[model samples]
Target: MSRSIDINKRTELKRLLLTLDVKAIPLWGKMTPRQMVEHLVDQVQWTNGKKTATCDRPAEEAERARQLMIYTDRDIPRNIFLEDLPDEYLYPDMETAINQLMTELDDFDEYFKKPGRIAIHGGFGPMNYDEWLIWHGKHFGHHLMQFALM
Candidate 1:
């Protein structure tokens, strides 16, 4: 079974991220290292309710994807893209982007402290805190691999 890096391991995540620089190129995707950091920041913000996006998939499809992706120990497929997400980088530099991603991760933990809190995911529809954590772990691991950081 494929296992994802634990998103709760902030120190380890930061250490890995610090190894990345703006010049690093992806092995399989279009996003630069800086853009990837910003993308993660955006995703973390969305999951924590700091940003919002509507579910684009049908309810049944979303549920099926949510079940397969969250429950199974499968790694996210390479080069997957969400059409609604921006391709351009958002932060001024890689450092700012990484800092923002870390901040959002911190917020993610705090936001889910409330009981029964849930957030909408574009592809997976509504997700609870645990589901989001698993999703982030997979998502981060995928990107980290894309850049050969893992």
Candidate 2:
């Protein structure tokens, strides 16, 4: 599969963000538009190795989860709340959130280019750049669908 952190994919993600408004409501989830964007920012930070996660399973099980979530074309399970994020990246409006996400996207690109970066996912264990990219894409797509953008 193509890595989801590529320039074209990031552009596509940005394009999707343009469809959202501050007052946009979710179709199937509870996060506000700003909250969803903040959630996405957290995910990107994790993928960029700015944050670390403890393994939630043994290596075998973690690998299985990674393959199922990152390699398959299945939708992420709905209503999953994996972490409690701080309000720092939670902008008060959609426009600001979009800008922060775009900036983080650029940071992710730079981080992914270096060697020996380690991204440790809570459930999926450690991930290389490609695996992290896939997870990030799946994650963003999931939240986008939550707000009826996908």
Candidate 3:
């Protein structure tokens, strides 16, 4: 299980992300700011709704899911697929990218305040909010790292 990110920490994270100067990273492959935003937007929309895409194997696959959940906590690999958005991907520019990120984080923050014991994660079965939080913290943090922002 993961811990949910508190609002304070989330706020600080947003502050940090908003200040990033993406152009500074010279070798983040060919992924443009539009591509990055689009990829991330797709992911957030997927989780918040039903526009599903590739996901880690579900908990029904038990052992593999466990292994991947463990890995999700660690460093995101180089050549991250999110940074390799396809030519067909649609994305807003840098300014809108940052705004959309902020919007989603705020929405998640509000969602966290509602009480529950378990959340049906994409692959990890029903997890308490705290569990989901730890996972989200790592997940979002990894991307922030990818953007050279956190």
Candidate 4:
């Protein structure tokens, strides 16, 4: 896994995400496009101080999520999110959802450019800038591939 999520890559992904006519990703289970974008962007906010999550996972479930993502011996699974996501804001239209998501994504891109900020992820524990980037890369990439037009 790459240690950094480049701004250019996020920019390219923004292109893919913006052009998508998709309202939801079917295979990963149903999530309105706004829901999916919101879900991912919240992680950025978690890093940026807009939001925080209690790492309340029990010893067992926490261990499970950790092994699935961090285990060196097995390939990362493509069909599931590392954890549940947020869909708090109900978006009224595709344009609105895409627009907001793009804005948030841009904020994240700019933040990533600075380097060295500590990221306090919801389930992943505290990470330096580099590790945070890898987590988002996998997460956002997963949804991008899922939501690509069929």
Off by over 4 Å in 1: 84-88
Ranked by TM-score, the better of candidates 2 and 3 is 2
Clashing pairs in 2: none
TM-score (C-alpha) between model 4 and the true structure? 0.64
lDDT of 1 by residue, 1-150 (tens): 654789899999988998996788789978888878888887898877788879989999999999999999888888777644466667877877888888999999999999998999888999999988889988998999999998
Off by over 4 Å in 2: 1-8, 84-89
**lDDT of model 3, residue 126:** 52
Q: How close is every model to the real structure, measured as TM-score?
A: 0.91, 0.84, 0.61, 0.64
lDDT of model number 2: 0.74
Per-residue lDDT tens digits for candidate 2, residues 1-150, read 322333337677788887888687788766777778877777777766577668869999989988888888867778776666455545767777787888877887788788877678888898887777677777776777677776
Residue range 71-100, candidate 3, lDDT tens digits: 454444556553345876343456677567
- The models' CA-based lDDT, in order, is 0.86, 0.74, 0.55, 0.58
Considering only N, C-alpha and C atoms within 3 Å, which residue pairs clash in candidate 3? 1-131, 2-130, 2-131, 2-134, 3-133, 3-134, 4-133
What is the lDDT for 82 in model 3? Answer: 34
| Local distance difference test, candidate 4 | 0.58
Q: Which candidate would rank higher by TM-score, 1 or 3? A: 1
Clash count list over all predictions? 0, 0, 7, 0
lDDT of 2 at 13: 79
**Which portions of model 4 miss their true places by more than 4 Å?**
1-8, 57-89, 109-116
Best by lDDT: 1
